[model samples]
Target: MSEENKQIAQELIDAVGGLENISSVAHCATRLRIMVKDKEKIDQNRAEDIDKVKGAYYNAGQYQVIFGTGTVNRIYEQFIALGAPESTKSEQKEETKKQGNKFQQIIRTFGDIFVPIIPVLVATGLFMGLRGLVTQEEILALFGTSPDALSDNFMLYTQVLTDTAFAFLPALVAWSAFRVFGGSPVIGIVLGLMLVNPELPNAYAVGEGEADPLMFLGFIPVVGYQGSVLPAFIAGFLGAKLEKWLRQRVAESLDLILTPFLTLLIMITGALLVIGPIFSAVEAAIMAGTTFVLQLPFGLSGLLVGGLHQVIVITGVHHIFNLFEIQLLADDGMNPFNALITAGIAAQGGAALAVALKTRSKKLKALAFPSSISAFLGITEPAIFGVNLRYIKPFAMALIGGAAGGFFAALFNLEASGMAITVIPGSLLYVYDFVPLMLYVITNVIALGTAFVLTWMFGFSDKMLEEVKTE
Candidate 1:
């Protein structure tokens, strides 16, 4: 392979004493990480010299080569073609569970389970925002009609758009959790449906006292788990474990019929009767904890969370927010986390823009400009590791700007119609209401402008340009 990407991969293999030295390999958003048979066999200096390789380091028993966003995936494709072990970031994450502490493993599992489901939530948020705008009294006045003038079918369509995801959310969560935890996804889906079955009293209506709950075994109150997150996730996990256990002992002659039959019967019974009650309490505690943080006095919640959100990104565990945001929405009917996080994300783009504008180095200019564009579009990995973090002061300046924006968001009591996105795309969540839309615009302006002015003024200087120029 004479192509540039292939050459990079070939050289990387050579630097690590050829492909034979590689035990396994994987990559994350920005780096290609490899475990080798002998650290002594690797030529670290030579590896760093390769094109598109921004830097190199050894950490946590893996030799990490920083290739920066899109470049890493291309180089990894070449690496795999050259006879290295085939792997993915998800598999890399799975390996981490074996090596990390319990809390870390749990976070990884949460990421694995929820990452696939976030897009649906984001789309639901967008539809909710659109439906809100279309249904508004002021908006309908332009059309010479009112919400009361709308037909029942039109209203039902709006409910389908905004409410279906949350309505069947438990099934989605259980299916994903079951897949992640190694069980039949179909079974998880069925169990989840049972949680929200029409045969049972609706959870929301029961909470509102419009319907009485079904009493199980004389004392336990039972209702549908509509919109619940943790209960479904835990049920899926325990069910997957039981299925695996059953598979090991069930005879080959009757494995198919007995294992699935027995597994479903026991899991559904246990979930409704015993397991569901336990996680319902756990879910409430989690909701309370996030609520406490969101309501911290005087915008302290926004300041702390926004300022530190990117810091958490650096550790690669930020997907943990998915669990919290969904729970917050289920409980509060609005998502303040969406408003709180966008400010920080906007600051990241701002910092990168400042660096791109101020830097004389062509290489730094090349990296910072596109990275800034991506950060604005709600993907900050490139902007972060490629530009701002490379210049320490820009990142710190951005944090201050984020804190400033977050303070205003909380103080204004701003809430979004959605989550799972931020910055430019995140603007969708605020469009339903004029006042909150203005507040959202102001939040980004403050964040972007603050970081821009700070970084252009003092965060960057001509001195740092020399290293970037040479590299």
Candidate 2:
């Protein structure tokens, strides 16, 4: 290990009351999460003062210290070299259940289930964006073909790339939910398949009055669930629960065969008759509510959501937005949330840059500069947790910038073709439409410029950069 890393490891061990007092140690994307045997024995202020440690807090029964991203991984390596037992993030989360509140647990649960699926969604979004670009009249003119002619020959290929994920989205949700809930993943995926079985009428076709639903008992209307989120999520949850219950009662000798048979039969019945129908309606209601909020006149809703999003990022519950974005994309194939939220993110980066530029202290500059770049890359943890939030005024300036940008986005009806990215990389989402690309650029530039100018003017001062001498 390097001399600097070794020293950091020793200081961290001491900050948490020595190695013996630590129950476990793990690092997430940005924080070093450490479980302690006794909370009183640790020194939070000292932990925060550790070199490269931006801030520290106790949440969900773990002392989480912000070390940014790459830096945290290196420091974690040092902790292992110092004899701290390597533990999984799942292990830390399991222990958190004992102390985390019901609300926190629910939010964390959603986060866990949704985070794993982002890569697929991001890829799908890119496909859709590309399709939009190629179909544009301006682009197609260069190829000596029109959108209609291209659609006749190449639309099926586009559908395979872009539509396949949403066509059977339920299966993916169920498969992921099952794995997270500790049930059989194969069983969960199979159950999801049944929801979108080819035998039943398509959900979209029925919604458009083009196909009739299958009437079970001649009273309850039933149809296939395609591109649905809640139905699949709840089905996975219930399937896992029912499977576990069956396992407990089924005899050891017949367990394998009987458990699978009983679980499938019962889950299918419950999904079609009860859970599926109820949750789909609930999901529709939620989608409508979200649309209403985002559509509120003058971008008031965007202002509120954009201004507060980073604050919630600190608590790590921002992953909940993944569900909402997915549902929105399935509805209209457009994601206003993606466009609206970027303003706050860009503003945070701007505020951090302002601090980096204005600070005379080399150490402070060193920390804030890279954090600003990280924020620009769409992960704001380093900028928000490391620098902006540490100084109250910069965070406040970022909020104003975020709010202004969000308001403009809403006013102009700016939206993205996909979800799960923002800032620099997010430019890909607006590729299909010239207007969106232009509007997206203006919104974020306004946010960044507003924050940078405001912060450089008054939000930050040179006096705050003074370094403390140590023995």
Candidate models: Cα lDDT each? 0.84, 0.86
Local accuracy of candidate 1 as per-residue lDDT tens digits, 1-471: 339899999999999888888878998887898877778988865775566766566544567887877888899998999899966766665555675467766787898898888888889889888888898999999999998999999989988988888888989999998899899999889989988888889989988999998889898877888889988998899888888899999998999899889878998888888777778888889888888899999999889987889999877678799999987777655899887788888998999999998888676677788878888998776677767876678899989888989999999989998898788888899888889889999999998888889999988886865554455
lDDT of 1 at 392: 79
lDDT of 1: 0.84
lDDT of candidate model 2 versus the reference: 0.86
Q: Which candidate tops TM-score?
A: 2
Q: List the residue pairs that clash in candidate 1.
A: none
Off by over 4 Å in 2: 40-42, 68-70, 465-471
Model 2, residue 468: C-alpha shift (Å): 11
Per-residue C-alpha lDDT of model 2 across residues 1-471, encoded as one tens digit per residue: 478978988898998999999888999888888898899998865775678876677777888887876888999888988988778998888888778678888888888888888788888898988889989989999999888777555888888999888888888899888888888999998999999998989999999999999989988878899989999999999888888888899999999999889888988888888888899999999999988899899789779877888888878778789999999888778899987789999999999999999988777788789889988999887787677876778999999999888888889899888888999999999998789999999999988988999999988886654422121
